[model samples]
Target chain A: METFKHLVNILAHPTIMLTVGMLVFLFFFPPNDWFEKWNRRLRLNFLWTKKGFYFVMFLMVVFFLFGLTDPNFSLIIKKPDNVPIIGLIFFVFIFLWISMNQALKNDNLIEAGEKPEEYNDPEDKVLVWPDLVYIEFIALILCMSLLLIWSIGLEAPLEGPANPAESPNPSKAPWYFLGLQEMLVYFDPWLAGVVFPSLIILGLMAIPYLDTNPEGAGYYSYKQRRLAIPIYLFGWMILWVALIVIGTFLRGPNWNFFGPFEFWDLHKLVPLTNINLSEIIYIKWFNRGLPENILVREIFGFLIVFGYFLLLPPLLAKTAFKKLHQNLGNFKFGFFIFLLLCMLSLPIKMYLRWLFNLKYLIAIPEFFFNI
Target chain B: MSDKKKSNIFQRLGESQVWKSIIRSGIPRTRRQRMMSVLNSVFLHLHPVRLPRHAVKVKFTWCMGGLTFFLFLVLTITGILLMFYYRPTVEYAYTDMIDLGEQVPLGIMREIHRWGAHAMVITVWLHMFRVFMTGSYKPPREFNWVVGVILLTLTLLLSFTGYLLPWDQLAIWAVTVGSNMARATPFLGHEGPGAALLALGDINFVNIGSDVKFALLGGRFVGEAALLRFYVLHCIGLPFIVMILMAIHFWRIRKDGGISGPT
Candidate 1:
């Protein structure tokens, strides 16, 4: 019993242990040399198709095993809270990785000006009705059958009648909104719930319009779209998915922080002493108290925020993203860069909230504005 | 019976004027007949006659879009069935749901409706992701992509508005947490950013009672009014909007050169 108890104690601390293990493993494991062996094997006549098939099978097996063995598997699926979101996030990442890997393999061929037929579908292609429709119809049947069976077994949750007087201690929005809900902890409600979400939607809408890249159409290729899609998806993972994971597994009652295996306690409060940049500058740099005027006090904040958002386009046009800048002219370039900065701000703010307890860059409580 | 006799019966049926009138053609033996089989049927006209062999490949397309449309059908059918037993009143809503699950005819319809709603949300997201990753939204297809985005938003809105219909704690709190965000819309909410500015010059242009939040909730808080509003939105309003948008979306896919293949 002691040994079993000790095993749970040691094994359940995945976050800390995994971080340590990863650092240690990476320090010794030179990834370039490891890949060189795979390259040599590939040159010795290993088929990429076979390799990819085996690799996917291997991943599926590993995932299946992990699900079976993970102690919190039940909690992850059975949800009144967001444990299922955590599970879905992991699965989503795995599929994303596989998709990226598949896309990457054909990237170089695309760059080398390979014909579309050589890589994927021929230009003069197949029909839509019998070919696509039959498969679609079959898929519809399979999906409906699966959902019906699952629904029969698992009833959707319905608790008692709502009484406005008794709100849940940590009332959650729907699983998708949990990411934004989590953000509300770090930023003001307006910024997290309203502005950032709007920005995400706007950015998504702007993708096809702004991204002038002519390659990676009708097929997936990481090389062809090495810049745009991956960067957007990676940012989405960090900002939204990561936040939801934290909100699901790491948050406890009273919106307190907790480790993965930590028990939720109503009173498990972590003392927060957050200070704004303006306040810090006022006291530390000028050796005086902060001003009451919102305009005077937050001018620096506005400059910092807008400057990063606005100025980066011209900077990119001159430097790292010059090609992109030329591809998409001034208007599109500025808009895209602005969207990127907004997306990037979520993670930046989250880190600041976590590390320094920095509440806001611009906090205007009089107008209920905190950013 | 002999194989020849069976063929004679089928041949006679195929040649009969009545059969010709219905089928507009004889038995489908040739490729042209196979193509006509799709064109001649009103129900089958939604599909293009014969697909490109490439279109059939599951991995390339992932069939995610089709899967989403299929799930929408499931949700619609099941939702209507569930609606037959449901009552939107605060007193009767939750009870009706329980009774529908336990005592009503095809009691499982309630469960199917609930689960199908969840599945619809998942499939819509997957479809959007698949489309984005494939870069199928470029050029003339851009507007279709925009329509797709609107449909996606409608999917979420439908799911959210439907969440409140159960009248349960989960439904209530979830919606409560969600609608509370509206109360922070810049010029709308009493406590929102632009509201203070709007309050100046001895006059208030906007406040909680007269803003987007009020219109959304139908009151200061989520209660009976909110439930009824959500019900209308979920069952009739949003669904009506989505149906029209989906029609346009599908039409545009055909117009935009069919599910974007390798060029």
Candidate 2:
């Protein structure tokens, strides 16, 4: 009884202790030198690249950075309209980022004049009949049996008839769309629900067309198809999957934030004051009352967002991602960078909303548009 | 001599004209016979007549796409069985589900159908992921990937429409939330965009009654009209589209020269 109570108390209060521990450990650690030494010890000389060690260190930083939060654990990220479940997201993001970095390094090496690999017959293959078909059949049987067993153990969920009057608290979409739902916390309906989803589909469909790297065609070779594969994987693992994880577990009553272990309360009414960016700039900064026309007010916002996505790509091509730009050419580079930044803006906008109550950069209620 | 005359009945049947006509080629003695064995049967032809050894390797393919297709077949069979009992009405829908589960013959079929729908989505995702991981989306296979993406969209849409059928809170609210996302569709959505642009005094071009969500629901909100439309889409319309697309996807795979692997 005492131990159980003690465990519960630790769970409830472990937030501060963990934050302190992670911060202290990070402060003392010499990440660069450690990664350098790690390359030799692990002997990633044969297959994997030395970039992997650096990525591992980066993962540690990412892990600890999120760990030192207000929540009792790193997995829970509490905000008014979002509670990001970080566990799976963290793991997946780390995997993606590191794998990408490693692949990039390896590809760079290969590009700078190195042998692709040994001479082996690419067409060497066995018969597909009994080999593939029988395996598929067995897998089918196994899956069906497993599903049947699971069904027998746990029945499918069915709630009472829906009453429009008595709405469920913190009414959420299906688990898959939870990321978008989470995004709704920081973004307008048009941006979060419609624009981003469309963009994601478009981006996915456009991958093969946009990516010109022809090295890894019929196989999985990180070195050959470094840029394309890593970028796509990173987007998939971090942006979509992570957001869904966050939405599913951390979002509680009234879309208030809650830790994974925390219980949902119907009365957890957070007195949130979400202010539009235009409101702050106009009403507070300029000492103006309010604009009668939404379109006029949203003009500044429209320019800013459009300008950011469009202008920033060329600027990046000239500077930070110079190699990428050089490799992909002008059009592809601009397009790729635009998509990347747009995807990145979700998290940025989300954090801003949580930290500073930023509802929308551009709020045009008349047009039912917000950015 | 009498014993010799009385040959095995099975052997005699095997040699009989009735068996010969059906069997076509006797015991598949040659390579041509082996090919004929596959070609002659409608069921066997769904698979390739021959395969590269690499194609057979379980590690290479993971069989997720095949499993997803199989699950779709399962959903179709179970869903048809379920439809015999389920009545899509405000008063009857929920009760019909309950009746299907408890009072109807083989009540478990409904549960399987419900679970199978969920499984199909998951399998499709895994299959798509596998394709991406293998870098099979490059060049000649690029259009196939697009087809795959469309199939994926169709799968999600089908699931979304089906969510409202049970008339339970889970179904209704999920659909409501899902459909609400459509309301934000730029230009075409009622409240989204172009409403102000296209409006001419008393006539708003885009509205709750005319938009995608409205068409999807067949009303202002989820009601009887929505349920009927959803039922039609889930049972007939979406499935028909999905089947055609799937046929294209498979044929493209064959045309692309069997399955992709490390080369």
Candidate 3:
């Protein structure tokens, strides 16, 4: 029993004496350059590639450092109070163990002279890391640091412990969702969440279909490329930006981006008149002939606004499609017109509500439970 | 003659639609070919004939997105394990959460599930942004881009739905506000034009007048009904949809020539 206990201690102790011993022995011993030799024989460089291999190793070491420093055992241990130094140590060993295994596999492959195709550069293409990588990496690092400081240390004060009964006024969703939420404040719920999101999905899906020129595949797909599609997408993006700005800047006291902008209350921001553009388009044009007029009017407000926003894009898309066929002379012309129509329509849709007192378009919370 | 009579497995596999071409060729020529031919039969279908090797190389993958997927898988595993002990009833839900924190064997599982969810969201978003920035959403792979966007939405929805399962005050009201926000959805939302049509006799047919709150709760408001509805959506419905979409997304990757970017 004492002997077993000592063995266990040796195996599991912080020093990890036995494991390190095995690792050291494995790292140094049995120098098999067989794979390297095989590569030489085949002119393959099977276990070669100097910079790539080094970069991979650097990555492994970085991962190791992260494991050591942060030690993500909080999920397993539930001790958010203190960092798990022991878990970090164990994780490091585990990572090292995996690395060792990978190394051994590489060594064995070298010995067997088994060269994978990746070992041979097909084009001998000059591989350069794009300049954007560093910029993105820096941005990422900044964002991560901000989040860590906010969540872990003293940046934003943690709102007092979870209070179930009282929801903080204008209780916001996460920032990214703020854009979507802001859209909701303006439009109907379905349009904000489902239709708009769905349209975004469909738009993304349509990218392949719209941008057919293969020349724009790898790089420089952005320049003077087909007019309509980019315009449509860009317009969509602009709307999102506008919504985010409105969500953050222009919204009333309740869901305002910066706490309580007292320029106007919810009432003014919510245009509650009869003549919003979206309403006119929907009530007059889209739902023109539907009988049961009285029954429809109650929901007509919702229907007109919803139908115009929902259906107008496709109708305009059809017009764009028709123009694509009729005026084959200039693809860009058709595309730009389609984009213009969509661009004009949505803002007009938004403008009608904002300027013309289309408060009915703003689906109040009561509508949620009533429906 | 022997020198000229070469049979490199790597070369052959490296060759065009290697497995498909082999299968179409009737029989394997040798032992190595046979082994590879079998692997090619099963796994090759999951990928394209040739994946422009450097394209998917780790440098391009950036490991961050992959790490996020890894964490998601971990979260799924640990979440399932925790679910075995967690009862999603309003009364027991919060208690289960606390219990998991205090009593669950590893307790790390719960923490992992929690933190992993957060990490997965951040990673997936970054993945989308990376794809966008690289112009990876361009043609041939456009549909896949859409799939990715859907996947991102599903991830957010999953996180939102899961938020309520903790059954804490934060979960209840946050979701209340969130769903209320959903209630304002432009086209389909009840508050928009759709609400009147969705109702009948002062009872919402959509929710039987329950609305999204009622529909979500199986009652008029956020109570036990809401908890159960969110539980099912989070655990079963959304995940199922996501998994199906994810399968389609991955398969499309191979079909669309594997991560279109700077070659």
* Winning model by lDDT: 1
Structural similarity of chain A in candidate 2, as TM-score: 0.68
Better of 1 and 3 by TM-score: 1
Model 3 C-alpha lDDT per residue in residues A9-99, reported as the tens digit of each score: 3453212432353333222221235433443465432222454445556775664444334323112123231122223233333332332
The C-alpha lDDT values of all candidates are: 0.71, 0.69, 0.51
In angstroms and one decimal each, the interface RMSD of every candidate reads 2.1, 3.6, 9.9
**Native contacts recovered by candidate 3, as a share?**
0.27
User: What is the C-alpha lDDT profile of model 2 across A113-223, one tens digit per residue?
Assistant: 753232135555433344455687799999889668655654566678867667687678766677788778777677788888888888888888777776766544464
CAPRI quality band, candidate 3: incorrect
Steric clash pairs (candidate 2): A85-A246, A126-B52, A126-B53, A127-B53, A128-B51
TM-score of 1: 0.87
What is the C-alpha lDDT profile of model 1 across B1-263, one tens digit per residue?
23466468787788789999999857766667767877888866666775555567776666777777877888888788777888888889988878876787656776677677766776676677777777888887898888888888788889889889998888888898888888788877776888878866877878768777789989988888998999999889998999999889988887787767676
Summed backbone clashes in each candidate are 6, 5, 35
Candidate 2: regions farther than 4 A off: A1-124, A283-300, A323-329, B1-34
Report model 3's TM-score to 2 decimal places.
0.54
- Model 2: share of native contacts present? 0.58
Off by over 4 Å in 3: A1-165, A224-253, A257-371, B1-65, B102-111, B133-139, B181-213, B261-263
Worst 10 residues of 2 chain B by lDDT: B52-61
What DockQ does each listed candidate score? 0.62, 0.44, 0.17
Which candidate gets the maximum TM-score versus the true structure?
1
